[model samples]
Target: MQLARIHHLLQVAILLAVMVLSIWLIGDVLMVVFAATLIAVILHNLAAMVERRTRLPYWLALSLVVVVLLAAIGGLGWSSGPAIAEQATRLRIALTTQAHSLRGQLNASTMGRTVLDYLPQSLGGNQAGGGDNGMGSRIAGSMTGVLSSAFGAAGTLAVILIAGLYFALSPALYVNGLLRLIPPGHRPAARTLLLVAGRTLWAWTAGQALDMLVVGILSGVGLWFIGVPLALALGVVAGMANFIPYIGAFIGAVPAILLGLSQGTREGLLVMALYAAIQFFEGNVMAPLIQRHAVQMPPGLTILSQTVFGTILGLPGLVLASPLTAALLAMMDRATPPLDEEDRV
Candidate 1:
């Protein structure tokens, strides 16, 4: 019996090792597939809505929705292309100028010089290969890095979008395939869990959209009222960044504050104060309101999810963490049995 138990333990260990190895090997593919699934979920819901209202076939409705969405995007881009391009250019230049000014100020102060001296040479753009044109070279290298990252991301996004279309086209096929992988005894529970997860994800997505919209509008109006340059661009960035929750707020605020600082210390302080007020209202009021109707994730758990997933898959993992957590929670709730009266007592 002892030998048998030891053998079983060894087998379990080996199985776990294999699982870990598999995950390590295919982590990128897994993330891509998961991202594709998220897109499919959104597309499926949209298609369902169209089908229900028009009494049309699912595929046809989905096709029409896709076309209309593409056309709408194209129309919007056509009308606002030049203005948006100009705003983006201005925002970039302003940020770069502000950064240089801040650096100059830092270099000019004795205390700042001390702090700067302690920093890495690479950060100062004076490392090897930096040469006489260190700043220019650094800028070139940074732009190259940005372009490469963007190019890679665009390719991955293209793959995800194409895969999403396929998944949305025949969701039942994939669902049934997944069911087939489950043991017969557990299929029913699996199906129920899937339903729960789907519903939870939908609620989370809808609420998140509402949250982003409110943040974007409020931020834009606030910045505009303060007479901040590139207010619209900053507001839009803030809104998009808010899609990531806690960390995103700070990420979005940095740019706006930097621009404010470029104007004056008073303006910077005002911007900071405004951001604080907005985030406070969002966290205390809007978040709770949204959570009550949508999904409730513990703050610590949300942060842990973001950290772990971000460590594993970078930005995509970080952005998907909250939604995935909600889905997992919903599945867990569905899977768990209610406490018996005796157990409760």
Candidate 2:
């Protein structure tokens, strides 16, 4: 019996190793699947909320949620699509212009000239105003303009949405089937693990959504009040980037501050101060409230997980890292009981 248990452990270890290697070697499909899972979790929770509150059938509630989401998206696009597009264009133009202007100023000073040498020449056109200048041209260029779409293509997006919908529609089918694979005695613990993970993920997602909305509102209102150009566009970028944790705040702030700097020294300082204040509010005021139900992920471990996952899985990995870590930590914490050491001998 002891030998048999050892063999089982080895098999489980080997299987886990193979899964890790597979994800590292060809992570695209896994990333797509993981993205779908996130979508399903979000949908399932929202539908559950709707079902309980309205005393509606789960399926009917889910259907209504889907329809409502689609309609909200369509309505927003119809009403504000043109304005968003215009703002995006303006944001790009402003970044390029400022990049060149900064480059020119740097070229004028000795230390600045030395610093410019490390950066890519593409940020600045052949002259102050010329074509072929986009902020995303080079990494050695400005950071803010480097934001790329995480959703790879239309087909992948469609697959994610469809798969997520199917999963959300019948999540129990998958969970129960997975539970069936476990040993009968272990099934209860496995179920507990799954429940903890799911609840953690859902709470984390909810907290993140709230954070994003607050950031968007604060940034938009603050920038507009300060007379920043492309305020709406900058706010949108900031809010979206907040999804990534600490690194994201820096990513969202650079372009706004740089553009402000292009206008004047005081403007630049104000933009910098604005972002600092926002970060302060998020970390001190919002984080505790947000973490009330969600697992409290330490700043250090959170960043470490982001680095590790981001390295392995790329953009999708980076975006989901914090939540994934939270789920993993919750599961680990609940894995066993704390008790006196056993004396089986």
Candidate 3:
């Protein structure tokens, strides 16, 4: 029996090692698959709503939901592109001018002079008559890489859309199929857990969408009120970045502050304060209330699980962590035997 146990442990170790290697090898494809799964979950709810409201068939309702989502995304991108581009150009020019002024200011400072003395000879005080051509070249290279990645992402999104459509149309077929793999007695429990997970995911999706809209509108309006250029662009960025939870708010703030600096220190301070306030309200008020009503998670465990899974899985892990944790918690609640009041006493 001990030898059999040792063999089982060795087999489990080998399987885990293989799983890790496979994940590393196909990380990009896995990301696309995970994205498709999340979209399918969201689309399932939308399709169900449409089916109930109208007399449309399941396929037709699913198609309509997909089409509407695609149209909304396309419209937003098309409408915002020109303005975002113009803002980006203005911001770039401002950054260049700011960098030159900053270089001069730093050079005049005591610490700057001390640092310059220790700098490598190649990058030292070599100021050409023209602007920072090296910086320009680096920026161009980065843009090219970004464009390439975007094209790759577009292809991945197409796959995800197709997969999501199929999943949304007849999700019961998928659920029934999965349930068949479990023991007969456990199937009911499995169904319950699945329902819990779906409900939790839907609630999370609704809350996140609302949060993004609020943050984007507030940031854009605040920036405009403060007379900062590119307010809309900055707002859009903040809204999208908010999808990543804790880290995203700070990342979104950097560009806003830099743009504010172009106007003056006062503008920068105002923008910073506004963003800070928005985040505070969203975190303290919105998140707690929504999560409490929708899907409750233990605070300390949620943060720790996010950190651990995020380290292992990167951005996708971070994005899916909350829902995944909620699902696990739901399963535990269902599977554990309840204690009788007598036993508790």
Model 3 whole-model lDDT (C-alpha atoms): 0.76
Write candidate 1's Cα lDDT for 1-345 as tens digits. 999999989988998899666544555566777778888888889899999999999999999988998999899789876776788899999988887887788889888877777766656532334465665554344323332355587887898899999999999899899999988998999998887877887888888888888888888889888988888888888888898889889988989999998888888988899889889989999999999999988889988998877765556678888888889888987788889899996
Q: lDDT of all the models against the reference?
A: 0.83, 0.83, 0.76
The superposed Cα distance between candidate 2 and the true structure at residue 343, in angstroms, equals 18
lDDT of 3 at 276: 92
- What TM-score would you give candidate 3 relative to the actual structure? 0.73
Top candidate when judged by TM-score against the true structure:
2
* Stretches of candidate 2 exceeding 4 Å from the true structure: 1-13, 107-110, 113-152, 183-185, 338-345
Worst 10 residues of 2 by lDDT: 139-148
Model 3 segments more than 4 A misplaced: 1-28, 88-151, 183-185, 298-303, 337-345
RMSD in angstroms between candidate 1 and the native structure over all alpha carbons? 5.7
- With a 3 Å backbone cut-off (N, CA, C), the pairs that clash in candidate 2 are none
**Candidate 3 local lDDT, 1-345, one digit each (tens):** 999999989988998899787655554456566567678889988888999999798788888988898899789779977888788787668766776776677689988867766664444543433345665444333333322366565765687888877777778898899899988997998899888777777777777788888888999999999999888878888998787566678867878887898789999899889999999988898888777767767767777777765655555566667667776787777778989989896
Pick by TM-score: 1 or 2, better one: 2
Quote the positional error of residue 178 for candidate 3 in Å.
2.8
Question: What are the TM-scores, per candidate, against the unseen true structure?
Answer: 0.83, 0.84, 0.73
